[model samples]
Target: MTTSRSTYHHGELRQAVLAAALDVIAADGPGALSLRDLARRAGVSHAAPAHHFKDRTGLLTAIAAQGYDLLAAGLAGAPGLRERGVRYVRFAVEHPAHFQVMFQPDLLRADDPDLLAAKERASAELRTGVAGLTDVPDARTAGIAAWSLAHGFATLLLTRNVGGAIGDDDPEEYFRSLTGLLFSPQLDPHGGE
Candidate 1:
């Protein structure tokens, strides 16, 4: 059941609107998001969203920042680069709306302090994951390669580009296997040359 507008306390309205925005983005993409539509979905007045987000960019910026913080947390708990890559894919799959907004610089406030800090935290986590691999000749290049592979796979999965090929297999498990192929010997810290 949906909460009525009258029932939302001061701060709850902001969360409610954000949740509603996520639903809209998940269902219809970020291009379909509108402050007025979010207000309607949240059962609030048209001006309600403006009170919190100020504008559409402001709302998307909030989502992007939240996404980065979530990504950082997910990566932090994983043991190694492979697991971190899997966690990154898992995050993108689970939070498609946030994932969509987080990478679209045109949809966000590039200079927003919160967004910048959150992005850096997530990047640091990725770098730390790559740094764990002692065999890598260049940590920076390795990190980029890992991120590209993971992000590309996640994007393909999200877009259903590989659905027919993946069939009923769990994407995460499939991803884990694929990573194994790439990381088996050369990238594995414990493996012999």
Candidate 2:
């Protein structure tokens, strides 16, 4: 009497495997993922994923790549760099598994070409988004500043630092307002003093 909960057909096992890996990572973080656990989640045999992923690192690399694609898309749709920062936080919250694996490079196959490509794509999009809103002359400085501000804001929001500053008055809105100061056009030469 096997009561199967999954309806995934055989042909879609690869995607099913990835969805299961993300499920595992979201629940337990990247370090806690195992092929056995992923298989269970995917409703496949324990050894099934080896044919697709080779190892746990391979699976994690795929998850991180997916994360980068998602992050690139999220930032691209933002109204401005400030809102892009907010969207960054939103993406992390919505894709906790991808965020966890992408940030913890040591946990995944950082050397994988696919993962590297995705990382570059996401990084470039983030930098391009910042450039679109700022007149920062040097590419490196703009990159550093944009990354630090967005990453720092995302880290703070993800860790619940918002409640301490805003006293629980809809923390997300408060966070958006604070980071808006970071990207204000008033910092420009003619926009403000």
Candidate 3:
């Protein structure tokens, strides 16, 4: 049987290390992450991760950048603001490790070029979704509100704070209903009571 210490080809090392890092984050949280541990998990020498990531912060920056790109992709082409919000929540639930690392700026290089670009891409996608809210008096504030609802709900779910309350309920469907309450005609600025 191949051992955990089995060597990977050069081209595979970076991705192998990243996958190991994600697994570590998922199982033990980011605080438990270490390049040496990831190297061991990826079956590489302890110094292998540094060849690709430079250091722990560099590794986290890569993860954060990747997370934002994934978030942007998930949000892209959504039909409307509500759908985009649902997609956002889905992304967080589906990629909990990435979601966990993506928001912790203290653990990342906030000025990393790839991270900044990916973040902007995700933001632009959300802005596009908000722009479709023609009935809202202020799209910017509306966008923030929509994002807050989705992010907060996802955070609650991830933390298990809402598990019992939402037991057996389809999270996406529940989120859709919540969005409906917020975006109902009664709340539309241009709609008459």
Error of 2 at 134 (Å): 4.4
lDDT, ranked from best to worst: 1, 3, 2
Candidate 2, lDDT over the whole model: 0.71
Query: What lDDT, from 0 to 1, does candidate 3 have?
Result: 0.84
Instruction: State how far residue 95 of model 2 sits from its true place (Å).
Output: 0.8
Give per-model TM-scores: 0.93, 0.82, 0.91
Task: Output the lDDT of residue 142, model 2.
Answer: 61
46-161, model 3: which lDDT tens digit per residue?
A: 89789998999999999999999999999888877777878988999999999999999999998999999999999999888777677668778877888899999999989999
Candidate 2 vs candidate 3, TM-score winner: 3
Q: Arrange candidates, best TM-score first.
A: 1, 3, 2
Question: Can you list the residue pairs that collide in candidate 1?
Answer: none
The best candidate by lDDT is 1
Q: How far off is residue 101 in model 1, in Å?
A: 0.7
lDDT per residue as tens, model 1, 63-93: 9999999999998857677778788999999
User: Candidate 2 versus the native: TM-score?
Assistant: 0.82
Error of 2 at 113 (Å): 2.3
